[model samples]
Target: MTDFVQSARHTTEALRDLFEATPLQRNDHLSARYGAEIWLKREDLTPVRSYKLRGAFNAMRKMRAARPDLGHFVCASAGNHAQGMAYACRHFGVRGTIFMPVTTPQQKIDKTRTFGGAAIEIVLTGDYFDQTLAASQAYCRDQGAHFLSPFDDPDVIEGQASVAVEVLDQLGRAPDLVILPVGGGGLASGVTRYLRAAAPGTAFRFVEPAGGASLRAALEAGAPVTLPRINSFVDGAAVARLGTHTFDALKWADPAQVLLAPEDRICITMLEMLNVEGIVLEPAGALSVDVLPVLADEIRGKTVVCVTSGGNFDFERLPEVKERAQRYSGLKKYFILRMPQRPGALREFLNMLGPQDDITRFEYLKKSARNFGSVLIGIETKQAGQFALLAERMNEAGFAYRDITGDEALAEFLI
Candidate 1:
């Protein structure tokens, strides 16, 4: 057997010391929808509700095994990684200090504390991730504690390879295509490395958040580069720069195989999975599944596996997710209307509404002109076609209106 294959197998066996293998289940809804055999590696079902624990556990285990006296570990994360490290620290009976961004949600902070219990100390540092990371590393260096990199270490990479080992064993055969969500590329690098050695024929597609396409950027630049700006909506997978170690492993990947998922579109997929399949996936977790429709033609009749990376979704974001999904699917709209300042004119505008269109929000703004008033309106409809009909009716009535639904600036300020 190849060295990588043997190493990954050994790691997989060792993981049983921490927790059982996460389930790989055939997804009926997705399989039927795409006309392909679709399986989900349910990493969300892991103890910390993410595949992150795999690498954390493996890294901690090997560190302790090699240096029996090493009793302190440190890491910086605002979400899943923190929980993973905390859980691993407790498992290893070691002291760990986790630094987190001050802006991290209370829900995530609570979850991390619960996972680590007394074994891990939670430190709230800077407002940004970079600052938190720097603080953690500095603390580790000064205190002589081992710093656990979230994705950029060789040990973490090897630990992540255990996922591929379990996948091959669980599926009985290598899938034709494997869809992976990319952040710093740790999971993708590790899984691809092991799979390439074990099942040379399997193909791969890498998905990243559109606002944070670090892998695509690195591939194009022939090296890792930091993005000037990144949208952190897909926090788990929205890394601004690919890690050096991870980029080295993933450098050979074809740029075309890297797909970008828009943050809004991901919300639609999250809602679909939650409502249809009863699967609760965070923005990053739903990425692999979100891209299935984009690859419907390519994946049809092929055995495909999508790694649902994490399920650490905060339920408080449900309303925002639903709103974004509605807007993306054209079920919701916002518009600015020039309405006449008269009672009968308001009645006339109300008459133009189609049967399926319902007014969700309406506000008449004070105007200097006595004859006209500006109105902000939010409408919900059963179908996108209803909007065209409503627009036509408004035009016939000589009502001046502009659809602000897709105007990001206006929508952000007004909605």
Candidate 2:
């Protein structure tokens, strides 16, 4: 057997010491919709609600085995990796220090602490991830502690290969295609390497958030490159740069096979999974499923597996998710209307809305203008066609308006 294959199987077998392999379930809803035999590798079901624990546990285990006296570990993470390492620290009975961005949601912060108990200390630093990472690395050096790189380490990558090992064992044969979400490329690199060795003929598709296409950027640059900016909505997979080690491993990937999922469009998939399939997926976790429709023709009548990476969603963001989904589906809109400051002006404008249109938000700046006032109106409709009808009615009635739903800068400033 290849050394990688043996090591991956051994790591997967050792994982039984922490938790069982995540379920590999055939998804009836997705299968029927896409006309393909679709299955989900439910990494969301892991104890950390992510596949990160696999890498975290494996790296820590190897380190401890080699250096029995090493009792302290350190890492910096904005989400899943923090929880993964915390759980591993408690399992191995070692002290760990986790550094997280100050802007991280309270739910994630609390969960990481809960996972590590007294074995880990949570440090809330830096508003940005780079700052937190630097702080953690410096602390690791000063304290002489083992630093855990979320996706850049060799042993961690080997541990993540365990996913492919379990997948092959569970499916009993190579799938026609396996869809993976790419962040720092740890999971994708590990899984593809192991699958290439084991299955030989399996195909691969990679998904990245449109605002954070690091893998695609890296492949084009012939090296890992840092993005100037990224949309953090899909926090788990929205990496600014792919790790050097991970990029080297994934450099063989075809850029054409990499698909980018828009931040707003991914919301639609999250809602569908939750409302239709009763699956709770974080934005990053929904990336694999979100692109299935785009690959509908290619995947039809074939065996496909999508890795649903994590479910550590903060319920407080549900309203925003629903709003974004509505906007993407054309079922919702926002308008800046210039309303004449005259009697019955509001009533006349309100009369232009169709029966299916419901006003969700209305704000009038009466003080900003004397003859005409600016009104911000949010409208929700039952069907996308209703929006066109509303626009027609507004135009016919001589109402001056601007649709701000698709205007990102205006939406951020006004909505």
Candidate 3:
């Protein structure tokens, strides 16, 4: 344990060549809301807008040191890691060939290319990530280039430990609790291992995307397990399985210590941070803060640190994020309404809406009979209770409707 922390601290010190330590700021907004001393380790402020560069740079530098002839690197990433690797490759003057799924947003591809400049080549292959990964690996083997695993490698884990080392040094003490967002478990495992060794008193709670609760599964199963399905909304942290190296360090955590951040609920946190704090956060970046309400009582009066992992969010998805957040918060809804064909029927139904209710979407599906039709209605309101009131009014008026806001299957197919 002593040797491990020593190595981590050394790595943290060496990272100064690339960039200054990311700031550890106390968050006034969250502190007041939760009645706790809430601090934010703003990993999102790094040069690459994420802590990924820490590991990438560390691994690349160490590998080059061991084998000076190794000048080429290869990686498969659809997001932040690719950018990080690109930046590091440019810094080292090494050739980097990054493979990304064809479906990757052009915004991300452009950013990665810009970061690497002449040091990297971008390849777009396969519609899915798994296929892209396979292609990158084959290319790496063919060219004798080192392949960088985002989280699985020992040196990468050591690199990620730099985050924890900075947190404790900057705060001048171990926080009572450190909240982390887990993807393939690199950051969480590195941070947890460092803190456990350096400050034995510090506690931790891990957060995973609800749809990709691989850590929770690993903890319960006593080994890593692949989930059958996972929602990719939190793209940065959505991994089907925990990395073997990461799970080794994290296996000590109890299943209860892991929290699930629902994808929709994470959007609310992203909006809040952006609007209130002027901090832009990607969906994965907001996971640590998104789970705060669930730990409100437990965290009260304690010193807590939440790692905001990344901020590479593309503004193009803002509307979708807002829509999801509103739905989860009960401020918006979608339903199928049975409307009568009479001339006065539409006006009567409109009267049921409260003053704050505004119709965002309205479409007639089909006029099945001469007397009635099925209409899709979407309403946005200030409060959730208004929906119940509107439903009651509709019932009394002998109208029929079905709420489809929470129905995923129906929403994908119809909405």
- The local distance difference test score of each candidate is 0.93, 0.94, 0.95
TM-score of 1: 0.97
Candidate 1 error regions (>4 Å): none
246-274 per-residue lDDT for model 3 (tens digits): 99999999999999999999999999999
Best by lDDT: 3
The better-scoring model by lDDT among 1 and 3 is 3
How well does each candidate superpose onto the true structure, as a TM-score?
0.97, 0.98, 0.99
| Backbone steric clashes in candidate 3, count | 0
Task: List candidate 2 segments past 4 Å from native.
Answer: 366-368
Ranking by lDDT: 3, 2, 1
Q: lDDT score, residue 257, model 3?
A: 97
What's the CA error at residue 185 for candidate 3, in Å? 0.3
Residues 1-415, candidate 2: write the lDDT tens digits: 3898899899999999999999999999889998999999999999999999999999999999999999999999989999999999999999999999999889899999999999999999999999999999999999999999889987888988888998889999999999999999999988998999999899999999999999999998999999999999999999999999999889999899999999999999999999999999999999999999999999999999999999998889999999999999999999999998889999998887888889999998464787899889999999899888778988888889999999999999889
By TM-score, who's the top model here? 3
Write the number of the candidate with greater TM-score, choosing between 1 and 2.
2
